[model samples]
Target: MTERLRRALDARPRLTRWLLAGPGAVAAALLFAMAMPIWLPKGAAGIDNIVFPLILVPLIWAVVFVYACVEESLLRCVAVICGTAAVCGLTAAMAFTGWI
Candidate 1:
């Protein structure tokens, strides 16, 4: 890894990094699952009743974009919002599917 990357990784404890990264990773996984129907082969079991938060993506992006336009802080609000939204969306989807 580059020195900068290594330093960034080493600055945070393993557990802290995992906790910080977990939500985004889970969101990415859920997003991928939501997109799987496009790749599933014919005659395979199909996805049903998916409650995708497609609207949330744009809404969050707009919020972030607006914040970016005026904010000077180095905070990572975009990741926070996206991660939280992902968790909420996934949980809602699961409940809607009777999986929760």
Candidate 2:
């Protein structure tokens, strides 16, 4: 039973592998982007208000492209973190400028 279960587990699609090493990261990024607005607080006072649309979106896309070509999961993680940062930074700048 354990052997069968292990095999089954192995057969299952791994999100980490897909996210970390496969082209699935691109798909994940797209899904994350599409779902971001829904999961994020659109009316929030910080990152949500600023980064979601511009810098973060482009950053995610760039990461997806770059990470898709490489096997490094760290780059993908960087993409996620940096994407958020880019968004937050842009948001802060925009808010400070009263563009929001």
Candidate 3:
């Protein structure tokens, strides 16, 4: 690891890093799940809606996991994750309200 990377990792508590990173990954997944019904085209008796989102969920989570781990600031990581969750929640709400 580069000196700066090592220093960044060393500066935070391991548990705190995990706490932030874990939720960021989980939020990414939930975002994908929750957004599926809202944004996916409903076709073939709804299989199309379910299939693509399920396929993308892990990809989304992996990307978010890496980003959360590599990001330099804990607060910014939390902000990104929480913002993602909020957007997902809002989109799901819109679906329920027949807005999508």
For each candidate, what is the lDDT? Answer: 0.47, 0.53, 0.74
lDDT (Cα, tens digit) per residue for candidate 3, span 1-100: 4565546745775765797568757876777587886667989786888788778888878878888779877656656777787888888878878887
Candidate 3 CA-lDDT value: 0.74
Cα misplacement distance, residue 72 of candidate 2 (Å): 6.5
Candidate 1, residues 1-100: lDDT per residue as tens digits? 4555445645654543444345444455455445433333434333233323333444544444454344332234334445555765676677568776
Residue pairs of candidate 3 with colliding backbone atoms: none
Off by over 4 Å in 3: 1-15, 42-47, 97-100
- Provide the TM-score for each candidate, comma-separated: 0.35, 0.34, 0.66
Against the true structure, candidate 1 reaches a TM-score of 0.35
Query: Model 2 lDDT vs. the true structure?
Result: 0.53
Q: Tell me which of candidates 1 and 3 scores higher on lDDT.
A: 3
Model 2 weakest 10-residue run by lDDT: 12-21
Error of 3 at 21 (Å): 1.7
Model 2 TM = 0.34
In order, how many clashes per candidate? 0, 2, 0
